[model samples]
Target: MSVQDYTSRLSDPASRKMGTFSYLPEMTKDQIRKQVEWVVKHGWNPAIEHTEPQFAMSNYWYMWKLPMFGEIDVDAIIAELDACHAANPGNHVRFVGYNNFTQSQGANMVVYRGIPV
Candidate 1:
């Protein structure tokens, strides 16, 4: 499915569901591994840690934060951000692509939530 479809699906309140990354790119592997490792080491149950992987999750630098966690499929990650944008259409959505000239492939789609009240 296209990112738009994923984004649309994310808005359905019922669509907030669990999911995982199909694969982590070499550049992101270490960080992703650490997040997973935290779950394993602290004995945090997967069911509890990654409460909602399917949609509207944030792409925090370190990963593993609740109501949402894990690396997630890039497609799914982008979709979640898109969903957030959809929910607040008037607000301009911006992003810092994975790798800027100076950055090390830290590409991500970050959607700052909400419109001005």
Candidate 2:
């Protein structure tokens, strides 16, 4: 059987399998907003985190701030995401939804692509 080398393809940032939305095309602002809305609708707390591209696969990530507890404003959540990205322009920024009842993460996705480390 002929084997194929997929290493090169995987080197691309878009090709790296990191999070829920990584396999899909980059999401637009509207799509991000919709996701945030969904999270809120489900009573999940929205949070932002960032990490260097090299550590994208690692379980540990630097939280932008404490999980935005009781925050229902979509715009506020998006603003925080923007702020996180702005502060860490060279780091991979991600958005997550925390389900307090289940005491676990519900949704996790990379929202910003950072420069390769």
Candidate 3:
């Protein structure tokens, strides 16, 4: 499905993968760690982003923090992911691996969905 269609399905409370690995299933923590490691090895920065459930269609996801570059600590990235999820528990959160070698192109994966708490 298209990104718009997949995003619209978020209201159905389903998770969707985007950018790289869109053809594969949702990744496990180990898989994520490997991917992050590869991104860092390639000198790409890691970034987190989220969009409020109400604004899922706005296509205006907010950045959780500044992109992390030169940081190879996977645990730290995971921690930031957890913190972002806690703060926006009802939104859609994603982990983005940005490659500066190419402008405006990166690997994105939806990694969190806040259930009502």
Top candidate on lDDT is 2
Better of 1 and 2 by TM-score: 2
lDDT of 1 by residue, 1-117 (tens): 655333424456443322323122222534544543443344332211111232235542323223223333444434544554565454433232222234332323223322222
Best by TM-score: 2
Model 3, 22-71: lDDT tens per residue?
54676788887887777777777899999875565557899998988677
Ranked by lDDT, top first = 2, 3, 1
lDDT of each: 0.35, 0.88, 0.74
Clashing pairs in 3: none
lDDT of 2 by residue, 16-104 (tens): 66755876688999999999999999999999999998777756999998999989999999999999999999999999999989989
Q: List the residue pairs that clash in candidate 2.
A: none
Per TM-score, what order, best first? 2, 3, 1
Candidate 1 stretches with Cα past 4 Å from truth are: 1-67, 94-117
TM-score of 3: 0.73
Stretches of candidate 3 exceeding 4 Å from the true structure: 1-24, 115-117
Better of 1 and 3 by lDDT: 3
At residue 18, candidate 2 shows an lDDT of 74
Model 2, CA-based lDDT: 0.88
